[model samples]
Target: TKETKLIDFNQCQQSSIENFIVNGNFPYESLEKFLVCFPKLCSLSINRLVRLNYLTEKDFNPIELKNLKSISFELHSIYFELLKALFKNFFKYIEILTISIYNDNGSNFFDGEQWEDLISTSIPKLRIFDFQHHYSGPMDHFLYACHSGDFRSEF
Candidate 1:
């Protein structure tokens, strides 16, 4: 008797396994292999995986995967640097992104000018931005920067 390996895409489908999970600190190469193997995957969830820190744009290259519409993850103590890197690199085709953060350490990551620059450069295509914070700071500032005309100026 001999063991066998799945090489062809159709063969892997016929093998009768679905919904793969990669846990622990594995290299991005393994993730890439999984994505290549299962291009028809509809949903992928990465939970509490610290190895995700090593993932970058290169790992997402072969991910023109069909039916991949949603990605869900929990990120605690997320630094602005990681957010910048993630947004800059991946999720070009993603329609929805949900992120949950725990505990606010009262750190201001961006100033008015920095926020303006970030909005202009990074998230041009974003239509809906929902903030769950209790008190939002300076709504007018953001609106004025993003929109051309002023409400006061109109009146």
Candidate 2:
């Protein structure tokens, strides 16, 4: 007899999948495989993924996904670099992006100066970008600038 690897709800739960919980670590390898296999995944939530280090655009096989719409996550303090890499890779087809950062640690999750950079560099086709930082103020100024006609002129 031989053992087999099966992907099911029970298998997902038994794995290191942290769903809707604080301070959970998601194995990016399994997650990438899961996403590739599960095409009908509409919404995904991984709260406070402390050890989630990297998510690059190359990891996603776009042809496999058909209905994936939303992804919510709480970023730990040390994963800012990973987030930057992830954003730099993905986010082109993302219609919505929601991020929550740890406030007590004093981390700058998405700065105002970076808005132009993000638009110019990574997410050029991004239609909507929503950010929620526990320590930072709202991105109203950047939103206004992006919405105003002046922003379009640059494009």
Candidate 3:
């Protein structure tokens, strides 16, 4: 029903929808579809109950979206290495980000330094970051140091 509504929305040729919530897959073919369909999109929320296919860096990159500030995603089987550039480039102007993703490796996402550097350098505009991480292994087994301050810097 939701996909149908999205399709039906295509009928309104001149429509410029600002905010979109996607419950299923949005097969962008390439990220260009987001730009072509919703040029004015500011806030985007996507909930993927089932991943039809794994996402890679190539699946990202809809450039010049200055209006897009808030984005949320529910993903599975994603690697931080693969999407590092997307965080750096694709979400350059993002002020708020929310993500719930399942990953097998803890080396990247579990590391506070990586996140701090990424946020400070790449997503400089980021103000609020809400994250839910899911992993298959015992996260405690990973050797990491506990910092004195918050998880932001000096971590």
Model 3 over residues 1-155: C-alpha lDDT tens digits? Answer: 44411233333353388998977755423334445567677998877523234443345554677888998877544456544656665677889999776554333566568787888887889989897755555543332222212345562
Better of 1 and 2 by TM-score: 2
Candidate number achieving the greatest TM-score relative to the actual structure: 3
Q: TM-score of model 2 relative to the true fold? A: 0.51
Task: Give the per-residue lDDT digits (tens) of candidate 1, residues 1-155.
Answer: 33223223333432222354433222322344555666665555554222324444332443454355454444433445554444444433444444433233113332335434444575444443332222235664454344322212210
Candidate closer to the true structure by lDDT (higher is better), 2 or 3:
3
Please identify model 3 stretches exceeding 4 Å from their true place.
Answer: 1-15, 27-29, 49-62, 103-107, 135-155
The local lDDT score (0 to 100) that residue 25 gets in candidate 3 is 58
lDDT against true structure, model 2: 0.48
Q: Tens-digit lDDT track for model 2 on 5-97?
A: 322433442233322232355543244455544445555666754433334432543333324445677765434545555555433445456
**Cα-based TM-score, every candidate:** 0.41, 0.51, 0.65
